[model samples]
Target chain A: TQLLEQSPQFLSIQEGENLTVYCNSSSVFSSLQWYRQEPGEGPVLLVTVVTGGEVKKLKRLTFQFGDARKDSSLHITAAQPGDTGLYLCAGAANTNAGKSTFGDGTTLTVKP
Target chain B: EPEVTQTPSHQVTQMGQEVILRCVPISNHLYFYWYRQILGQKVEFLVSFYNNEISEKSEIFDDQFSVERPDGSNFTLKIRSTKLEDSAMYFCASSDRDSPPEAFFGQGTRLTVV
Candidate 1:
């Protein structure tokens, strides 16, 4: 089974602090996606990186797919209280169906 | 903006009872999926459906679980017999043919099997 492991399961920081969450896997994937979920709600897609070494930015969040396609990372610059949520990373296989396998996720709490 | 929608935001069922979760994907989406997240755990894929048939499913999708489109607009997941461990938040998602991997998810149904 392909498994994605995320680091620093829980994080709490003052507003404006920067934080980075990492997702690593022994298996390679064709694409990777990041999502943010609010309490009691489904996850909302943040960004998708299909190419190795690819990087995408959405407002204060930056997502990077590793060069080997076996890992990815999310970095938040000057995180605000609004940025607090559970961040998840999912890897999609090369198959046409590409059912994604998700990581355990990192819960972030940014205090104002 | 178009989005997936699911009904019965929460459900409470007795163990061994059958339950069906409903979802309505985006009108133009061609790929549909069901996923579940146990409390404090990662989201796990259950099944993926395309062309009115199941394209792929995870080991978690056993004989006890089934999925059906039933109609052009509605997709459903049925649990034949619920167990205490079956309790979780079930999410329904969909994506277009243009980007079959980029899924848009619904608010989810929180199922509590007692």
Candidate 2:
């Protein structure tokens, strides 16, 4: 069984602070994705990084895939109250894998 | 830019009752999936459907659960019998062959078993 573990289950910070959430695993994956979910909403795809050592940015958020494809990270620069939400990472074994196992997620709270 | 859509933002049912959660995946997507998130818990994969058949399902997807495409656009998940433990938010997702790993999810339906 593959397991994706996310760090800092909960984080509270003031506005303008920078933070990073991590997702680590013992197994390699062919692809990984990051999602942000607000209350009462589904997981919204933030980005998908397929190559090891690859990085993608979406405005204030930066996602990096591990060099070994066994881990990933999300970095938020100058996080504002609007950046607050549950961040999740999911990994797939290969292109054909029907299901992607998800991490427990990190709940981030940014206060102004 | 299309999105997956799920019906009945919330559902309430009694123990031993049957409930069917419905979803309409993106018209052009190929892979469809069902996942559940218990209150304060992580989202877990229940099953995956493709090509008019079930491609994969997690251990949590037992005999009590069933999934069907039913039509060209609708995918549904049926719970044969409800239990308190089944109370959670169910989300439907779809991805296309162009980018098989980028999945779009529905807002989800919150199922409460009384």
Candidate 3:
């Protein structure tokens, strides 16, 4: 089974601070996605990186896919209270496989 | 933007009772999936549906769990008998053909088995 591991299970920082969360795996993925979930709600997709060494930016959030496609990272610049949530990374292999493996998730708290 | 929608945001039922969790994926989506997250745990894949049948399922999706697209837009997950361990937040997701792997998820239903 493909497994994704996330680092820094919990993080707390003052607003305007920058933080980086990492997702690593031994299995190479065709694509990787990042999601942010609020309390009591389902996760909302933040971004998806499909190619090795790919980088996508959504405002203050920057997502990078590893050169080997076995890992990814999410960086938040000038974090705000609104950025606080459970961050998740899911990895998808070939299209025919038909399923994705999710990481344990990192909970972020940005105090205003 | 279109998003998956799930019914009965919360359900509380007695053990051994049958329950159906309903989901209506985005209108243009072709791939549908069901996932569950136990409290404070990572989300786990339950099943994936495409072409009117199950395409894949995880080991956790045992004999007691079943999925069906009874109609054009509705995908349902049925649990034959509930147990205390079954309690969790269930999420439904869908993706359009243009990017089948980029899925959008619903708000989710919290099931509490008593």
Candidate 4:
């Protein structure tokens, strides 16, 4: 089983502050995805990085995939209260079949 | 954007009782999956279904847990006998292709076994 470990299990910051969450694993992955889950709801996909050293930007959120495909990071700039949620990173192993393994998750709180 | 839908957003059942959680995945999706998140814990993969059969399943998907696609649109997960440990938020997700994994998840059903 592949295990993805996310750093900064809990984070709290004032609005407009910046923060980065890290996801690391010893096993290599074909792709990595980031998700944001609000209270009482399922997770919503934020971004998916497939290539090594890849970076994608969506508004104020930036995601980066490691060169070895064993780690990923999500950075939020000028965070807003709306950005507060449980952020998760999932790593997909190269398999003919199956869903990806998810990390423990990072709970972020952006105070307005 | 089209999204997955799950029925019975919340369910409360007694121990040893049977429960069925329902989901309707996106129309174009070909692969389906089930995952559970215990409160304050990581999301765990339970099973993956494709072509009307289980393509993969985790150890957590024991004899008590089963999945079915009763119709073209509805996917369901059944727990034969509920236990206190089974209480968690169960999410149903779907993906269009298997090569590069990108799954869309439903709102999830929160189950409470008392």
Candidate 5:
């Protein structure tokens, strides 16, 4: 079973549209990270949020962690084709070896 | 910027054959990791190594799987017998700290078992 669940497994939108993707889990995590991956390449780290109820923004992309630390969301405003890629969320639990648990990922496609 | 480097961008091996994937993590990093991703699927964590020992492993990592840091800079993963299900892109990663720190990844080695 997947440790983390991501919503909207796939997304397709036009330029200038706004969209939000979600990651949820029943287990609380000490930290959560988001990454973006293009074709034929490894995932690139985007941001890491450690505190619950925390919100961070990278230009047009906004990330928020749930108050309970069991969920997170990524929101993009005025999306462009450059934003098209697979978005992944991974979490590290408070227990164990600090290895990450990853969600399936959300594939986004923005048509220009 | 420092980067993780993996060898053999792609490999084609027969089932029941042994294959070793090698990685050179960023210098001065304290932790090393191996992750895999099947086509059209999420990245799965396989194992994490620290202080010359395996600190964590996933259920997917079976007896046939083994990891080693033979030298100061190289981390290697060995599959004693490859299975059809083992076909995937294997990524090597490293981090400077153990506390969910920023992990840098290699381009990944695509393994094809037939």
Candidate 6:
């Protein structure tokens, strides 16, 4: 089974702070996706990085896929209270019907 | 902004009983998937369905779990028998492409087996 591990399981920061969360794995995947989930809701797709060393920006959030496709990172610039949520990274194998392997997730809390 | 939709936001069933979760994926999406997350745990992939059949499924999707796209738009997951451990939030998602498979998920069905 392919596993994705996320660091700093819980994070709390004041508004306007910047924080970075990471997702790592020993397996290489064809694509990696980042999602944000609110309480009692399913995860919403944030972004998908398909190429190695690729970077994508969604307003205040920046996502990057490692060169080897075994890891990814999410960075928030001047995080606001609205940015607080559970951030998850999922890796999809090239084969296996494109099923994604998810990380435990990093729960971020931005206090206003 | 199209989105997936799931019915019966929450379900409560007794152990050994059967349950069927329903989902209506985005109209144009061709790939549908089901995933579950135990409280405070990671979202685990359960099954993927395409072309009216299952394409792939995780080991967690044992014989007790089954999926069917009975109609063109409605996808359903049936658990033959429920156990306490089966309680979790079940999410239905769909995507148009496969390269990255950027999926959109529904609000989810919270299933509790008592």
Name the lDDT value of residue B33 in candidate 4: 95
For model 2, the stretches where C-alpha displacement exceeds 4 angstroms are B98-100
Any idea what lDDT model 3 has? 0.91
Which pairs of residues collide in candidate 3?
none
- The runs of at least 3 residues in candidate 3 whose Cα sits more than 4 Å from the true structure, single-residue gaps closed, are B98-100
* CAPRI level of candidate 6: high
Residue-level lDDT tens digits of model 4 in B1-114: 899999999999999999999999999999999999999888999999999999989999999999999999999999999999999999999999876778899999999999
The models' CA-based lDDT, in order, is 0.92, 0.92, 0.91, 0.94, 0.93, 0.94
Residue A29 of model 4 has an lDDT of 94
- In model 2, the Cα lDDT at residue A35 comes to 92
Worst 10 residues of 5 chain A by lDDT: A93-102
Candidate 2 per-residue C-alpha lDDT over A27-52 given as tens digits, one digit per residue, 9 for 90 to 100 = 99888989999998999988988899
Question: Residue-wise lDDT of candidate 3 within A1-112, one digit each (tens)?
Answer: 8899999999999999999999999999988889989999998988889889999999999999999999999999999998889999998888544577899999999999
lDDT of 1 by residue, B1-114 (tens): 998999899999999999999999999989999999999889999999999889889999999999999999999999999999999999999988524288989999999999
Q: How far off is residue B32 in model 6, in Å?
A: 0.5
- Give the 10-residue window scoring lowest on summed lDDT in candidate 1 chain A: A91-100
Per-candidate TM-scores read 0.97, 0.96, 0.97, 0.97, 0.97, 0.98
**3 or 6, which is superior by DockQ?**
6
Per-residue alpha-carbon lDDT of candidate 6 for residues A14-93, written as tens digits (9 for 90 to 100): 99999999999999999999999999999999999989999999999999999999999999999999998999999999
Runs in model 5 deviating more than 4 A are: none
Tens-digit lDDT string for candidate 3 (B1-114) = 788999989999999999999999999889998999999899998888889888788999999999989889899999999999999999999887424278899999999999
Best by TM-score: 6
DockQ of 3: 0.62
Docking class of 5: medium
